[model samples]
Target chain A: MSEASVMTDELRKQIGVAGEPLVVEMEKGMLRKFVDAIGDPNPLWSDEEHAKKTKYGGITFPPGILAAIMMVGNRPPIEIPLPRGLDGGGEWEFFEPIRPGDTLTIECKIGDLVERQISMGKAIFIYHDTVWKNQKGQVVATSRTYGLKY
Target chain B: MAKQLYYEDVEVGIDIPTLVKHPTTQQLVKWAGASGDYYQIHYDKDFAIATGLDGIIVHGRLKIAFLVQMLTDWIGDEGKVKKLACQHRGMDLPAVDMKCKGKVTNKYVKDGEHCVECEIWTENPEGRKTAPGTATLVLPSRGK
Candidate 1:
């Protein structure tokens, strides 16, 4: 059997660490549902009149709305089933506003892999990074996700 | 419905508007559909309990959306959120109200962008910070 440390390094080199691309469409219903489900009553995302008056000139996505879109999917790049995924938090950088009907293609890779001994036992902290680009090939946003798996 | 925050007007130590949100299992269900993170830990109470959680917990990303709202609402339409980062330190269960808050930490101008940095977090009903992080923004200057 492989030691935990060795397993961690090997997983980093093999999976999401291998750097792969996943594509997903940014749908309007999904975007609206995300804003509504979060209990956000922002007119900019819902009310057409309010959105039309804003700089976007139409409904726009909230900055963190991508969390719901990026996560939840069984896409490759970071496809390791380590079971317990503890929340390590995430970082987001926005370049352009995501408008309605835009398709986003993501390129993801694993960043840092460190082994830690916690109260629960031994775990590996995985840093996942993904860049989001619009169909026009413009970089729209990027995120670095932090997760812990044991 | 909101005034734009001008770069010259905001000072360090200013507070972003606070947002208090109460999440429910139904909301989590909706989130599950939207995010695709249908991990039972967020919606299945029985499975969560069997796994040792108090109950089905709110998705940490959902809490992040609430915090993002606070920051964006405070800046109004003219400002831009350049970066946001947070780490989930505590679990937040549904049915409890969480407070999303932020305070300015720094202000500066770089590359012609009037930038501001603030510390942001969400506090569970028990008054413990469940998520803590930082955000950077660029607001339009009155003259620029």
Candidate 2:
């Protein structure tokens, strides 16, 4: 490995280390803003009248709302020596609908690390595994996010 | 939201309705604010160029959100998205047409829930699959 490689002992040590739990309350206004930004006109996400008639009986956010919640919530940050980082996409498994007023506690941990030689030179891929539970302690969703640092 | 898509209606090899998006810098700014990414590479052209990118690029998570919207719209109110996975293979520039498309890959009843699986992706204007992924959805049964 070159001296400039972003994969360091410190980053490797973070693998499998869990971060502090982040609690986020799903707010209707925030959900509206998120859906609006996506340009999604789904009434279930915004129109209270339409949402009240649905099975959820209230505004239930789209699955993508989880991304907003996770992105904005506070979590331990991995210090990569690299100057730039890019999102490598993610995987999500949803077990229940997230409705307005639901309090979700998200727990995250570094799952793994891999070093790859790319056209841009050496890069380190960090995998984070996160679990989302409701106030009732039921796992509403679990996700894995991939981040590339170079 | 044309009609409620029932489990019996979906079949392997069928294509889901496509959603086309024309993402602009304004939309990216809105997304940055709402998503709290605040990454200059997504909105600041000069910063993105300095970082070696062509220019400001679309947020990968925003594209993922588009894919999610397509799935949710197709499934309608009665259906639920169970699992989704995506990989950002290439960067997409602003003001480009990105089409979100999917095709059913599998259908089955597991654990009393009617499930459907699909191969989903966001295709850039060049017809390249920039963000390829898979999704699992639960659709209501017509028999029930």
Candidate 3:
């Protein structure tokens, strides 16, 4: 959440670093649930003994999970006045596998706005860059998302 | 661990195995909780309808994961998923069959590493693509 004034602050607060990077704990339970939700039946994501034999040394969430790591707490709404929003897609880069028990810092930087008209309506392709770093400060993953603000 | 996929063994235009996903409302709720995307449109039916959307829609990110799984599953143990990107062009509703499909578009030796690029996507039952994307992966060569 941003510590800012209500009105103009909404824009100001979100324009910058987009508030503090959320700290997320990749607990075992959460990873398991996420694995199930994705329908990934791989034992590397659920089986403890199996994961112990692998290079990751334990269960890990698929790299795609990093794209949404900012959801640990209540995320303040984006102030864009566009009525409907859709995901325009993103470039996600994974550096290291996200394992259970790892703590991550998620940083988001907005302001890559390209306003253009689409069939849906007047849409702005809002780009957001987010990086996830582990407690050791190693960058685990990075993502650039184009959110369609319409 | 699955057997490592060798780069030399793969060829361009080869279809990787398909992974079919059934996105349920329960899974969306779990994704919303774990991923921290509490968007009402993803899990709240009434809220989504009020917001001019059809009933609860599946999260785009979830579909992206399905695509990733399609690659990672075929790439196997020694293979590495280097880069991936996707665009959400359509909405995916719950209880529908979403097929994750992909094929190798190119193969090359980059910095002495055998690499393959694949075009991947998830299609709804009507056969319209919901999420289309690309992925680059490095696989071990048979000799190396």
Candidate-wise lDDT, in order: 0.81, 0.88, 0.79
lDDT of 1 by residue, B1-144 (tens): 478888888899988888988888999998878777788999888999998998999999888888889888888877889999998999998988889999999999999999999999999877899899999999989886
Two-way DockQ contest, 1 vs 2, winner? 1
For each candidate, what is chain B's TM-score?
Answer: 0.96, 0.98, 0.96
Give each model a TM-score.
Answer: 0.92, 0.94, 0.87
lDDT of 2 by residue, B98-135 (tens): 99999999999999999999999999988999999999
Candidate 3 local lDDT, A53-142, one digit each (tens) = 877777777776765544322233576766676777888877888888889887777746665767765665767777788989998877
Ranked by DockQ, the better of candidates 2 and 3 is: 2
Candidates in order, interface RMSD in Å: 1.4, 1.4, 1.7
Q: For model 2, state the Cα shift of residue A94 in Å.
A: 0.4
Cα error, candidate 3, residue B118 (Å)? 0.6
TM-score of chain A of each: 0.81, 0.88, 0.80
Lowest-scoring 10 consecutive residues by lDDT in candidate 1 chain B?
A: B30-39
Model 2 lDDT, residue B23, Cα: 97
Candidate 1 lDDT by residue in tens digits, A1-150: 134453445566654543556677777887777887887877777788888987889888898876664532333444444667687888999999988798877777776777777677677787767788889999998888878876
